[model samples]
Target: MREYEYHAPLSLERLFELAEAEGMEVRFLAGGTDLMPRISAERNQIPRDRKPPMRIIYLGGLGLDEVTDDGESVTIGATASLSALLDNGAVRTKLPALHEALREMAGVSVRNTATIGGNIMNASPAADSVPPLLVLGAECLLRSAAGERRVALSEFFTGPGKTVARPGELLVSVTVKPGRGGSAFRKLGRRKAETLSVVNAAACVELRDGLCESVRIAVGSAAPVVVRCTGAEQALVGKKIDENSVREAGALVVKALSPIDDIRSSAWYRARVAPTMVARALLAAAERKRG
Candidate 1:
């Protein structure tokens, strides 16, 4: 790494002013989990107008930490640490699917250092938080000196490592309405822990009379952006839970995914495994409903 000037902005306004003024030359310093690696990686170096890469605007000092529930919705601050989410009782009870993914993310040391905002901002295709958030139908609050804007979680990502957030905007927090439905998150990785996902999925199902009243399914690492499987969801709407209904829904999910061949797994393999994963998630959600 090269020496660079660091600015510790206490609030969102200051952060936006710096970012808008600096433009592409300025980078937000959230957890530094993704930022540091991009700078030091031997294969691809940060495009520096000079030697030190770019200036970092540190977000660590910002007083943005909060997790609140008003019984209507939950607002999670962008700066909230992954470690904090894992230990939060309200999160475990209310958003168990999301919390389960957070707890299973990387390892204790890495989870300690990674921030939820960083994860969303980086816009990684395989990010652990994306699928769960997508399934929950969360909304992100993006703030800049100009104003604050809110976007649905499904509309957040434009591409891998890219977001619709403007140059001056910083993600302030994410909000999700409390649901009475059961949800599940499942991923198939190269190994158990700390490995990037090859196929990952999350689903939320509102059950009535042992049939799906409403359904939302999201899959990651299978496309340029995290995808919401509306086709699969439509298939399950008002359909009774059975082997045939489940199998048909799973097939629709497989067809909806845009899996590509990669070193981690082949497109064929991803296609085969995706439906099974979705099936598994459905079963898990059903179990939650029963319990």
Candidate 2:
């Protein structure tokens, strides 16, 4: 990395103060998994020109580093690591689908270093957290010298590795509502672990009075962003979970995807499987009612 000053503020306010003065020149450092690799590459590319100070705002010390319940919903601190959530009971009880997604994310070692906030902030098109969290209807908390804003997780992502986070603002936490439903997450990657997801998804549904009371389905890597299938969901929102409704809903899901042909997989293949994934997830949710 190039030469520059480094400051590790013990508090968020101080971090904001430093950030207000530096702007883009200041990159908040959390876990440093993505930034460190980029920094290393930048240094190698420019041996002559002095690189910018790997000016990092250490998120490790930030007080927002745990998962907690607030009666109605769960708040995940920005610095909460994946490994930490692997064993959190409340999380497992309320949202095992997310835990299932995490367990299969990357590998154990990478999970140890990857933070929930970083994954959301990075907004990778193939990020495992995005699809499940989208299905869970999560929101993000951002803080900066100007103030704090609560943005829906769906709105937080702008594109690949991009977000609405402004200068001096750092992601503080994520909030998810408490829910009782069956949810499932699946990913298609080049390898079993530590691989990019070619496509991934999460489905959640609840039945009341033998009719689907609510349903949320989200798919990723099949579009520019993780998208909830409002149309498909509408098909199941009030109907009983039956073979015909599910078959039709699955078709709706197929219409929702907009995958692209790439080295990992083809758009046609992704389109074909998207509905199958959604149907399976819905079936999983419906089976819970019988048990």
Best by TM-score: 1
What lDDT does candidate 2 reach at residue 125?
80
Clashes of each: 0, 1
Q: What is the C-alpha lDDT profile of model 2 across 106-177, one tens digit per residue?
A: 898888888888888877787888888888889999988778899998888887778898867889999988
Reference-based TM-score, model 2: 0.91
The TM-scores, one per candidate, come to 0.93, 0.91
Clash pairs of candidate 1?
none
Total backbone clashes of candidate 2, pairs 3 or more residues apart or in separate chains: 1
Q: Write the per-residue lDDT of candidate 1 for residues 132-200, one digit (tens) a residue.
A: 888888999998887888999989999989999977678889998848888889989999988889988
Q: Please, what's the RMSD in Å of model 2?
A: 2.2
Q: Which ten residues in a row have the lowest lDDT in candidate 2?
A: 46-55
